[model samples]
Target chain A: MSGQTLYDKIWQSHLVSGDDEAALIYIDRHIIHEVTSAQAFEGIELAGRSIWRSDSILATPDHQVPTTEREKGKAGFVDKLALLQVTTLDDNCDKNNIVQFKLNDQRQGIVHVVGPEQGASLPGMTIVCGDSHSSTHGAFAALAQGIGTSEVEHVLASQCLQQQKCKNLRVLVNGCLPLGITAKDLILYIIGKLGTAGGTGYAIEYAGEAIENLSMEGRLTVCNMTIEAGARSGLIAYDQVTENYLHGRPYAPKGAMWDSAIQYWRTLVSDADAVFDKELIIDAKDILPQVTWGTKPDQVVAVTSQVPEISSAKDAVQQADWQKALSYMSLNSGTAISSLSLDQVFIGSCTNGRIEDIREVAKVVKGKKVASTIKRAMVVPGSGLVKQQAEAEGLDKIIMAAGLEWRFAGCSMCNAMNPDSLASGERCASTSNRNFEGRQGQGGRTHLVSPAMAAAAAIAGHFVDIRQVELAQLEGIH
Target chain B: MAAFVAHQGWVAPMDRSNVDTDAMMPKQYLKCIFKSGYGDWAFDDWRYLDAGDVDVDVSTRRKNPDFELNKTIYQGASILLSRENFGCGSSREHAVWGIRDMGFKVVIATSFADIFYNNCFNNGILALTLKPEQIERLFELSGDKAMSLTVNLQEKRVTLANGEFYSFELEENRRFKMLNGLDNVATTLLKKQAIQDFEKQHKQTHPYYFTPLR
Candidate 1:
């Protein structure tokens, strides 16, 4: 018999029924958020259906939550439509009897962050959310993937999701990362190596030395952008890093159950001779503190590099793509990525709003003020807990004192869904994913970077190599 | 929820790569409670000169004559043609809903994002993938004009107006579902007994999964 890959092993364990053409995969945890779940709830209500297991779901309002003026509560939401979607979520969860962390709840944050933090995203489980970043939970060896609103309704009506088999692809990152290079830089570099569509029709398992060396926060960041590479899901085998992170979370298994959980997680690794349909290997040492130069995530280069010339495109399609992106971003060919000035610098989102990410930001800008040329700079923590923890460590004070607003948490400034967003024609050095045209706002341009890079950009008013930031400022990042 | 047989529509060539769902349905329009009104707002930032808002009237917005869909020749074009990785980015079904609401029953691209491709079938929209050369050829065939194509799911081919058809692959189950317009949830519910049985056994082997975390 052929050896099974990690995705295959986890997939077999979750199989409820059927085969490759279509299979009913049992979903153990369904993470729900406001923007996507509202319609799904409406669908179930219209169909006269109830959730298969309300306990299996965790609900929160993140995408549309106001990230500032928390004293006003929901009234803080300046957009009435945003307020409506958020309140509708509360009503749906209330009617369905599902547990939800409300706006005032400290547990509330992005679904991707809150799920793992609360321990709902456990190893060897199948977790689905309406948002694509559900892949973030795959860091714990869970079969996590995003579902659309239609599938979300199906999961609510029936805890099983019908799926076709996805081919297994392995991304092996070898060697050790440099001192300041992060999981964000590594993943961005990988996406650039493999074009945006490279992972289509495949489930990617990230393996090798560097992936194993990543902290759970870093692993989550890598998995969060799995969709950006066009893969529905990304996974890393369960390890001590995962177990340590899951330990003592409110939702994690306790006592003797922990033993059984670990024993099962141990078997989640790929067999030695497992064959993957495709494989891409990268040396971690080859990666630099990366930054995106174009609208597409794959249009990235090292922070020290210049915007790629159209003549350098590998194919006819890329040549055209390069030109289009250069036009949309208002950047000329051959401009140094570091010389690009920014109107705003945003540090937050599921990808980089964790406590570790916050600490990195603080370390970079501890006593420095945001550059005067920058219009605004802010740090939105991933969740209420992340904010609380940052405050406890006085990291928020360090950030705020650097002339950047240490704001409340949600999916703030990641996309234009919330009150926090880029103004028209503004160029921002952002830690959030997706620099797609107008993703931040209409005519808004975004440069995707790591927390440390975005922090340094906020201070310098331009993209700068984090490695070039003064030595004293880089103290704790390594 | 709608049945698909064959679709014949004018091709609206976007001629761009990596066209994301955020472009299909921008974040501001996602605030709509129902999915239907996204028609006018689909490609809101590109289709209109002004920034879109769910609260404001879409009619008041100035239409950008330069946008492919807004062009006089491609007006009401129901087949969206684009380059690789179309519908990449966030998993918003609003992307599919808005495209469908705008009357696009089919999309032909070099490739598509996983989530958006899946969402298309659930909404009775046909998402087709052709080889890069074939897509480039189609772009040349439909340059700056209204060119209609017939997308036959049954035949598993798309026939250009010149009677040349390009074959595409669709797995049997997905083809069957598209042809009959199957509501996947209804079909899955038929196996409730099987799911219940699985649950019973799952609890025995992995009781930790069933334990409530909160």
Candidate 2:
């Protein structure tokens, strides 16, 4: 028999029944949010079907909810469309008997953040959600991926997804990460190297020294953007980091059950001789803080590099794509990225809105002031829980004192599900994934960067290489 | 669900690669939770010169003559032939909804991102993958005028207007689902007993996952 990779082992274990090509993978947990789950619940009701197991489904309202209701003096969503969607989600979850962490719920946060924090996502299980960043759960060794709305209904109605197994891929990163280089940069760099479609038809397992050394939250950030690379899912084997993160959480197994769970989790690693359809190796030291200069996530360059000239494009297609992106972004080819000006700075998203991400930003901007040229800079934590934790640690105070708006949690400006959006022709230094045109708003331009880079950009009023930032001089001065 | 056994329609060639879901249906449209009525909104930014808003009349919007879909040659086309990695970003199935609502039934690409591919099948739209060279040939065929092609699911072939044929392969399950118009919700429900049994055993082994209802 062929040796099994971590993905193969978990997939096989979750198989309820099917052939080699297609299987009904038993979903251990289903996480849903307001934006994607409404139609799904509506679908079930239209079809006269009840939720198969509401007990396993956890609902929350993230997208389209006002992130700072207390600050804005608004009780709930003021936009009619946003109000309708959130209310619909609440009604649907209630009708289905599914537990929901609503906007007012103390546990309310981004779906990806809340799942791991509540211990609902665990090692050796399969998790599915409606948002593309669902792969974030794979950091715990779970076989997690984002499903389409119909598949959402499928999971809701039957708790199973009819899935064709993806081929295995291994991305091996060796060596230690350089100082100030983050998981976000590493992933953006990976996407930059592989292009957006590099991992098509494959489930990638990130391995080696760098992968093993990343914190659980860091690993989540790495896996969160697997979709940005066009991979179905990303995985990492469960190790002590995974165990420690899961331990003592609200839903984590207890006592002897925890011991047994750990025993099972230990088996989640790929066998020594396991093979992969594709393998990519990168030296961690070679990676630098990355930022997407163009529309697609893969249209990226290191912070130190100049925007690529159209003439340097390998083919006519790439040249044309570059030209279009540069025109849309109002960026001149061959210009240094560090010299570009930013109209706003946004440090939030499922990608970098976690507590750790906030801490990184707070650390960098502890005593700095937002630049006069920067119109607005804000921090939207991933969840209410993350906000509370950041407040507890005084990360919020540091960020607020640095002249950045510290708002409540949600996917604010990540995809413009709420009013925290960029105006037409506005350019932003963003910490979210996906630099696609109009992602933040209509005709809005985005430069995807790490949290520290975003913070530095806020202070500089333009993109700045974090490595060169004079933090000491900026501190306590306007 | 509607069956997609065979279809014959005018083909519009979109030469660009990595046509992500965000471009297909921008995040601005995600605010409207209801699924249908997104056809006019598909490729919203690229489709028009002025910004398109929800429920805005398409007639009033200034059409972008440069966009592939807005070109007179490709008007009324019901099939989209594109290059590699079509629909690459965001798991928003609304991308498929917009494509379908725009009246296209089949998307031919050299490759597709996984979620977008699955979303197409679930919505009764056929997402056909062709070899790169074959896709190149199709692009060449649709270069001048709008080309018409016949896609047959059972025969597993795409026949060009000139009678040139290209064979494709689909996994049996996906093929079955498309031919019969069955979605995952329907097929999965058939295995309710198995899922129930698995859930029962899963809960017993790991009861920690379930949240107590307040």
Candidate 3:
């Protein structure tokens, strides 16, 4: 018999008895957010069903909460959405007895951030949420992914999810990533190499030397973008680095239980000879600071490269898409992306708004001032804890001194759920994921880049080669 | 409730492709978790300013507004006539809520993002998929001063008041639910007795395991 990969073992163990067409998998943890859960809760209420396991479910209001404090129901410019979101979640969670980390609660932030902070996320657990970014939790060696509202309703009522088994794809990245390149850049490069839907119908297992060397934060960044590549979930084999991060966390096991937990987590790695349905090997050395020049994540090029001409594109569909994207973005075919001007800059979201991401941008923008031409810049942290920590480290001061708006932690312009957004025709260099037309706001153009690259653009008033800024910053530091 | 057929009134043409969830309903208006009243905020930023003042004239807003939907051709459109692959990106239900709230009864396009299309149907929004040529005709008629189209769900046809007609398809289950405003869970519960029987039988084969409290 072949050695089972962690994906196979965990999946097989969670399978509950069900029809041949679908397996009713026992979900160990359920994460809910205000956006998708409201309707599901209503469905549950109308169907006369209560939550099956309130203790196993966790909720947080992130997407719609304002990053700045406005008096409750005061009707500030951004207060309408904020008040409605916070109150709606507050009322719903109270009625259903589902645990919620509200705005006032210290634990409140993004659902993904709160899950790990509150200890609801653990190894060998199946986590489901309405938000696609729920894949971020796979960093803990858990099987986590987003589901639709109907699936959310089913899970809330039964604590079981019906799903089909997925094939395993192993992505191996070898060699050391050069200094200044981050997991964000690596993932963007990988996604660019493999079209957005390349990993459809697969659960990805990230391996190889580069992955093994990543910190837990770096691993989380990689797993968080798995969905962008159309993978159901992305995971790194658990190791001491994983255990170290989980230790002393709110929900982590303590004392003897901790020892036992470590032992079990050791068993989560794939065996040396474990087979996979597909394997992709990436050369880390070749990856440079990356950015999205078009609407989709796959429509990317190196920061130094010009936007490719549609005529040269091999695929007819790709050519058409390139033409459409170029027209919408108001860019010429052979224009150098590095020369493009930016109207705004944002460096925050569940994808790259962690403490490490903040520190990286701070290091680059420490003494730099926002360019006079750049009208607006903001850095919203991912979580309350991240915000507090950044403040303590004076990272917030560095950002503010640079003339960027440093606000409270929330999703912010990542989706424009909050007050922060781009005006129409305004272009932004943002660290958020999707760059589709008006993803930041209607007619707002978003060029997705790494946090460091965003900081560089904010300083230069345009997309400059991050390499140039990094070299200058290093010289200053020395 | 009476059965209503989809009428093809004047189809408002939005030639822009890859319209995303945020454009459909900007996130700023997505605060209400109950999935109610969000329809008004669907394009809140594009429609009005903070003080409820019209930022741009309706024609100018549609013609040269900063929002993709405002670009001249797609203004006050009850039926969003678009190219292929509309509603791509995030699986936000706000997109559906916004479209339904905007008084758009039907979205006629060549294709839609998988999640958004499913969401549109679930939230009682009609998403009609048609061939490219048929959509082009609707776009052509949108420019006519005398052109008014109606989407009659009962007829399952989009018709111009002048008798230009186009056929669309909908699954029977979806059609029944939309006509009755029934949610999937509500539909499933109608078969509660069968579900309960299946649950009881399964319980016998798979006894629940209890973990003792420490």
Best by TM-score: 1
TM-score of chain A of each: 0.98, 0.97, 0.95
Give per-residue CA lDDT, model 1, range A115-232, as digits (tens).
9999999888999999999999998888899989999999999998989889999999999999889999999999998789999889999999999999999999999999889898
Candidate 1 lDDT over residue span B1-214, tens digit each: 7678898989989898888999888898888889676788788888888766877788888998888778788888899899988889889999998899898999999888889998999898999999998999899988878899999999999999888889999888889998998899899999999999998998899998998645
Candidate 2 segments exceeding 4 Å error: A71-74, A470-478, B203-214
DockQ-derived CAPRI band for the predicted complex in model 2: medium
lDDT of 1 at A414: 90
Under CAPRI classification, how is model 3 graded? incorrect
* Ranking of all predicted structures according to TM-score, beginning with the best and ending with the worst: 1, 2, 3
- Give the poorly placed runs of model 3, Cα more than 4 Å off: A1-3, A70-77, A470-478, B1-19, B32-87, B96-214
Query: In terms of TM-score, how similar is model 2 to the real structure?
Result: 0.96
DockQ of 2: 0.69
Deviation (Å) of A179 in candidate 3 = 1.7
Ten residues in a row with the worst lDDT in model 1 chain A? A469-478
Worst 10 residues of 2 chain B by lDDT: B205-214
Query: What digit string (tens of lDDT, one per residue) describes model 2 on residues B97-135?
Result: 999999999999999989999999888899999998999
Candidate maximizing lDDT: 1
- TM-score on 0 to 1 scale for chain A of candidate 3: 0.95
